[model samples]
Target: MSFARYVEQTDPPRPPRETLPTMYDLPSENPEEPGLPDEFHDFQPELLRITFQPPTHLPEQVFSASDMNLYYNVRYPNWYKRPDWFGAVGVPKLYEGRDLRLSYVIWQEGVSPFVVVELLSPGTEEEDLGRTKRRNDQPPTKWQVYEQILRIPYYVIFSRYTERLQVFILQAGHYQELNLSESKVWMPDIALGLGLWQGEYAGIHRLWLRWYDAKGNWISTEAEQERQRAEQERQRAEQERQRAEQERQRAERLAERLKALGINPDDDL
Candidate 1:
């Protein structure tokens, strides 16, 4: 059956899980929180989906990496920020295989994402870049979370408004800025790479982050590849038409030469 038909047949129902206590293990909160910007709510979920891989286990929710819980008690009393995207290459598939979490708890899971990406915004930009100091009483800056706490190998930030992209690689226990050329940046650790490109994803025509092949080529989107194939077919048809026209012109010229020599062009026939 079609997905739409299946959903139409079933009734809407609540998930069979209770709301966990609103423990402030991290500084995040519902959109109702005061001082939270309006735009944050609009893009937070999309940012998460774009940054992380599709959940390996759950076919329903796209951002199941949150269940991995990368910040259970890594830095107690300090808040955790779930990045827009993250990847933990060598981590185990599941922890105990039950009691799925709503967020990553690093203490419970020994691994941290090899790469962490933060989507840039006015509120989070300063903290994301680590330019703002962590007030003596407040939680660690976004910079601290990726560089010191998680010790992630690669940290990336992309600004939607300005189309700016930045990369930071851990060197000597701290992050040092990596250079970008046009739209690509190199991350040696992942063996692959990351970059921002102009393309359509999920029907949205905007700049989006994507992985690259070993040769530093932007992996083409499925839609783009299909469009390319169609274009190639069109070009091949045009070439065939041109070749047929050329052959016809040559036949006409040969007939004219036979007439000029007073020879019957179709005598043999």
Candidate 2:
């Protein structure tokens, strides 16, 4: 029977959980249908993962993944969704507190992602924006997985082509589109904000999605922080050299004055 017909004929209105196929009932991936992520997809997610820092969580307690299979439903052990980038605050960085994870299984981790980001691609734009419809008996679309099933707190979509950013926050059991006038969205619980930054990342100069602190400062990657520290040191050294030059000139003037008085400057020295 069609899913619509099944719903209407049932004596009691059945919840989606009862009528729809859960994550476990679906396959994780299709061998024939492979994902081909472009350059923007590769670089943008790395930037987000590197800059993800939750103020209240330790490095060991916060986990972030890019293009990793995220297994969501307990009943559908093999069913999973792969997010472009996703972060969880309360989970250990290592799987089972020992080895790195091959995939993020929600049932084992006991923590849903705090935030998810999708770098819009030509192929997945409609589903990413929740504009696509799911067929009956098919696994839920990416939108359904993140919004209805996982209930991720923050959902972000960025398009490098237009340099546009969209943010959604879950409220009252539904995702609400947020108006980002400044092209940024702040999450107080995580003490961080996400925004489009125009700067060089990975030697590529373009607008990219990055994290910002609560005080409105862009969180720096390790390489960026190192470069900044090196620049500061160079400035300090230049200032010191200028001070030394001034001191030497003053000493030379004093020596010349002593010589004019027929007194050896060496004696004073």
Candidate 3:
């Protein structure tokens, strides 16, 4: 019998997971060079940074970065993890109160990231999802550095292809997956929530992860706020015009009635 006919006659089929190369088997990086980010990686992080509003902190006290190398180890000083997007509350927006930081050093900053978001990429999926094993000599993996060493409070992962969002919160020194309802995760400590927003951002409209207020409303960007203000002004002007037109018609009717009664309306005026 042919191989196809024999398989069709078989009672149970073989699983692809057994034969195919798993994520672990794939190389995480090339030793010679760093990976280049795609367009989604650039745009998504910008949206998160723009909309991130920590209610309790001032604008200058909240620092959010994208594709920035975060150095965690004090001993080695060179070991770092590059997050797609990360937000740190209670930290000065400027490093040492004056300069923009090229990278975030945990030891110098003394404040760990309040939240870290990683956009899923096929090349780094294993490490991003904490599926890869850590070597004994090398520094901790990205997941280990974020969860164990840095102890970041919130870790979020989003897959563009599947449009799936996963939220993990640090509880009792461990990371626990949150059961998000409608793709929303609320952080009571920061008084803000993160959810998937469907709208145009940077001239592209799709599902983007963004911050929302406590009342479950998506936080607006500066451009969006301006657009809303302009719309409100237009509506007010329209209402005023309608009111003026009504008053003018009423005055004209009264003038005609006075003329019909043999009284000159202009003489009384």
Candidate 4:
């Protein structure tokens, strides 16, 4: 099917609330198909958990937790895409009785993810780049999904095999490729940015997506910070012990000098 025709028939109107539940209320797990690989399946979830945090509270805007699946019904009902990691800044904080949702339903959430990241794999390479062709009746291509419909501010794709990072920023309702310096790009929306650093994360070392400060310093994880603190404490303790030993040696010298003078310290006391 041609990509152009699919977008023509898709309904631009929003669905009614009574019809179906939003994506957020559903489970984040995909029952029909297992996602990516063992490494991605495990680490991606951890990334979602660690990265997902809302900004300050507001009357109309709410924050979305990471790992929430985003869904939109287009020409094809079953067609959907779940980014390995995602974050929406201006969504409501709670839904119904729950703290939030498992997936982000655009029709229901009333907002789209500000940023979406896809961990590239051999199987998903074509689709992640919007090169996959669906039936002519289907909606926009994967490229169109992030670019046109979602209009997400930032879209990031990382290939583990190649250790490459690509960034897309929304401009005039379309995505323009952004230039990177040394494999790193900054996004002020998430109060962080994406960078390709050769280091260990979750015990695996390769090119990895990690947060960084505005000055381009790598942001350390909680565990990394703790390790640094412990090392500093150890150094301080060793210094104290050395100082005490020096004092003890000085006292011994003074006592020896007194003894040589036939003035025993004990007798004087």
Tens digits of per-residue lDDT for model 1, 151-241 = 8888878777787888888998889987666666655554556777666666667777776767766656556678899999999999999
Tens digit per residue, CA lDDT, model 4, 1-269: 43345455554664455766555445667677764575755574465445343333353354534344567653333456677777666666665435546666676666777877887777778988877775646545677888877888988888877878889899987788888766877776655666766777788876667667666667666787799999999999999999999999998999899999998877846
> What TM-score against the true fold does each predicted structure earn?
0.59, 0.87, 0.86, 0.77
Off by over 4 Å in 3: 1-35
Stretches off by above 4 angstroms in model 4 are: 1-15, 18-20, 23-30, 44-68, 73-79, 91-100, 253-269
| Tens-digit per-residue lDDT, 98-119, candidate 3 | 8877778776788999999999
**Model 1 CA deviation exceeding 4 Å by range:** 1-72, 75-78, 93-100, 220-269
**Residue 219, candidate 3: C-alpha displacement in angstroms:** 0.3
Highest-scoring model, TM-score: 2
- Of 1 and 4, the candidate ranking higher by lDDT: 4
Checking candidate 2 for backbone clashes, the offending pairs are 24-76
At residue 67, candidate 4 shows an lDDT of 40
| Over 4 Å off, model 2 | 1-30
lDDT: which is higher, 2 or 3?
3
lDDT of 4 at 38: 56
Give one digit per residue, the lDDT tens place, for model 2 in 115-216. 999888888899899998877666767887888778899999988888889999999767899987799998999889999898999899988899999889
Q: lDDT of each model, Cα atoms only? A: 0.61, 0.83, 0.84, 0.68
Which 10-residue window in model 1 sums to the lowest lDDT? 59-68
Candidate 3 TM-score to native: 0.86
